[model samples]
Target: MEKKCVNEKKCGSCKYLHMTYKEQLKKKEEFVKHELEKCPELKGHFKPIIGMENPWNYRNKVTAVFDRDRKGNPISGVYQEGTHRVIPVEKCLIEDELADKIIGTIRGMLRSFKIKVYDEDTGYGLLRYVLVRRGFATGEVMVVLVTASPIFPSKRNFTNALLKAHPEITTVVQNVNNRTDSLILGDKQQILYGKGYIEDILCGCRFRISPASFYQINPVQTEKLYSKAVELAGLSGKETVIDAYCGIGTIGLIASKHAKNVISVELNPDAVRDAIVNAKVNGIKNVRFYKADAGRFLTQMAEEGAKADVLLMDPPRNGSSEEFLRSAALLGPGKIVYISCNPVSLGRDLGVLKKLGYRAEECWMVDMFPWTAHVETAVLLVRKP
Candidate 1:
């Protein structure tokens, strides 16, 4: 296998744009294992992390900007690194079949309407970017059309045209981003068509996703990730588990049946509301949702004498803050299940936990982001007696 970079030096999305899929997976595995060795307690427990068999076309969502080529043809795709010039990607090897089809369809429609693509230089044009998200379990598609202006009469007509043409699109949201900056999403959103949200089923738990809410992009591998996390938690129906940074309460909802009680903490109010709705939809009553930061919630729980036999932490890519890590270490549950998308940060946090008298008993990796360098990991750490 040879190294392959789709746009070579043009696109910065893929840092390892020059490496083959196999080489990338191998390098990632070695990287995780070597980092684990830095934690003396985790040295022997670290195993060869699993890799995805099909390492291409696995992305469920793609955000592509709109631009124009030298020939004046409307080009809808991502931008080249360090330049506003768009990388005219007719087909992305990392996205699913539906994503590719939708991109092609939208590109043709934009060309037909002669819709002026967003120009970063002059800050003119209506169309800014297209966000496409697909449900892996239900095969539902949500298309969010972001524009620099309101839904003009012509753009509304275009939106109607898309709905009339494609029935697979379950939700169509028009997001207005009138700012001159490069922020893709705005606070204002209006449902243009179909249901306002999409549903995703994981471990028999259904989750509702909004345009701004964060859900696992890879559904198949996310099941594997959550399953591994549950296994590491060692739920026995008698333990209370705290799922920290629990986005939409998927982990807590799924693990509720195995644990006596599940407390889910999330910062986003929308996500918390969605988590409550999901719990009701799934008929889960053992889970509780808290609209608060995970670290603050944990500190409050400690103050209130709320004890948990097991704790699950799934922080964002930036990993847990030092204060959060310190609070988690102070709580010192019997078992800790750490799920991380960034192995480097995972290793660093695991070092903190090890110093707090917790030892890594098991570690596994899930190839959540295929065809990309990102990997998800699950680790079980036990309090040393």
Candidate 2:
């Protein structure tokens, strides 16, 4: 029998908590196989799903919303799915243990600090949410305070208290998000303590992660996923590679060591900035980052008569756009390694790629979100000769 979480029904984060890990893996494998069956080119090319040996507490990034219970005590946890009700979680099974503890400490200190929880309805309070990110290999921690206003009273004392409680914390940043929308972060930010960012090692490559950058939530599976992605690319140190939707240049930098050169592109300026720094930090001189839309960049590369040996694309959950797919064909890379978080979108894109003269040869799944229903996939497609 599988162990159950105390607030399992309310939090609704771990959809497969009731099922054993083996059963969960089987379910995801079957789901991916079923999704891919829609595309004929991908049929009979499915590989076994990669499941984690220890799946619990695998989430490196933890975000909890702040609110007060009826008794006026401060609390922090995730919001109940599809609703605004905040489910008070003392500890979560999927989150990092120390990160969760630090969040709990912050919640406990709110009352003593005379800090008010942000009220969504009345547009009041200081803190709206708390986000914690920990580096698995380096044990570096970054705490981001999402606030309704920039002014934080007694912030110095609060930072000192938090550091005293959890000395492992490397940095603290205050992000002002005063909007009424559901977004977690705002445009404005200020560093309250330490450096504004934290660094971590992935696939022997160091990466700088900021509050807004898109780093994979699961570090353990990320290594497997990225290693497999680069392996499937079949880089020969003589091939030019393109890494699209490259956030902070994680996959690009990892693949750089094996390839002749890598061109990474992202729309977010902050991520592009971090990617450039990450390449320098790793002393990887063969890779360059561009702050442009992936589709547009690929289209221009094709127009410039440039050719790449491999194309590495990790698009959003919605998958790659048709414009990007068409341009990828125009560029005509011999192999295209597509990494996707959503299988349904992956299948749709596979069909589009097949029409554009590419065929999915092999595909594998990595269990990035253990108890959750989500799975990550990497597919290798070769140009149809």
What is the C-alpha local distance difference test score of each model?
Answer: 0.81, 0.93
Which candidate number has the best lDDT?
2
Q: What's the distance in Å from true for residue 194, model 1? A: 0.6
**TM-score between candidate 1 and the true structure:** 0.93
Using alpha carbons, what is the TM-score of model 2? 0.98
True-structure lDDT of candidate 2: 0.93
Alpha-carbon shift of residue 100 in model 2 (angstroms): 0.8
Give the per-residue Cα lDDT of candidate 1 at 255.
90
**Which digits, one per residue and each the tens of the lDDT, describe model 1 over residues 235-255?**
889988889998888989889
Candidate 2 displacement at residue 134 in angstroms: 0.4
